[model samples]
Target: MSGLMQKEYERVKLHATVMNTLFRKEPSDSESPRLARGQRKTRESFDARSVLKHFKDYEFGSLTIPNIHLSQRFSTGQDLYYQCVAMAALPKS
Candidate 1:
């Protein structure tokens, strides 16, 4: 994939991973202003460093893509696997 496409993919993956982690953590103090007001608060926002730390040293499975046309690359599933692995290997930054 092109660098721009790769970057965009990474951004989306990171966001999803971070959001999942955030919601999975323990609930925040309900005594806080926002919560005290009875407003619902699901998860708090965190910095990139925190998200990177959560995903550091993670690894994903590898894949082998068959030699084929772009349009049919993922028809056999291998190409999709390869793309997922490629995106997972991207930098956490």
Candidate 2:
């Protein structure tokens, strides 16, 4: 899981860098006003390190994985069964 997370983080960082570079380039006069404004805003506000830090913190920092163990004891030749469970923490509204 850690290895996969690291790879995803690296990918996101690279994508952010590419997007920032693209945003930094000036658009031609024929470009739409809305697009030009959006690009300007992104160039001014996008911080790759900050974005990466947020991603790391959200995915790794606050996440919790509890250790779960299952045990079974059978008597009188009865069968035993167990079901898998999954849980997630959602933000409170």
Candidate 3:
């Protein structure tokens, strides 16, 4: 009777292991080529000049801020200086 119970317990354990393996979901290792191609197309179509031009037009036309009065260059330089300082302060990996 004890031998039979031990065999039944082993069988049930093996069955549970097999069922878990069969139902487990595996993660995809790589992205589909179609998705990669679509991403590349989107990256290719991004134009920095067009974006800058749009912002420039909005700033001047809507805000009525003349270029001569704008300190954009100075502000950009200041931002870059702070960014550089912050990056330099980060510990090297």
Q: Give the winner by TM-score.
A: 1
Model 1 lDDT tens row, 4-93: 232333333221121444335355546545445545456666577986888798886775644332221222355442233222233333
lDDT sort, best first: 1, 2, 3
lDDT of 2 by residue, 1-93 (tens): 433212323333211123534235556636745555324344365557977877775654464435432222221122333232323355554
Best prediction by lDDT: 1
| RMSD (Cα, Å) of model 2 | 19.2
RMSD of each: 13.0, 19.2, 28.9
Q: What TM-score does model 1 achieve against the real structure?
A: 0.22
List the lowest-lDDT window of 10 residues for candidate 3: 65-74
What value does the lDDT take at residue 21 in candidate 1? 42
Q: Candidate 2 — worst ten consecutive residues by lDDT sum?
A: 69-78
| lDDT comparison, 1 vs 2, better candidate | 1
Reference-based TM-score, model 2 = 0.18
Error of 2 at 89 (Å): 41
Predicted structure 1: lDDT: 0.42
Give the winner by TM-score: 1 or 3. Answer: 1
Q: Candidate 3 at residue 91, lDDT?
A: 35
TM-score for each prediction? 0.22, 0.18, 0.16
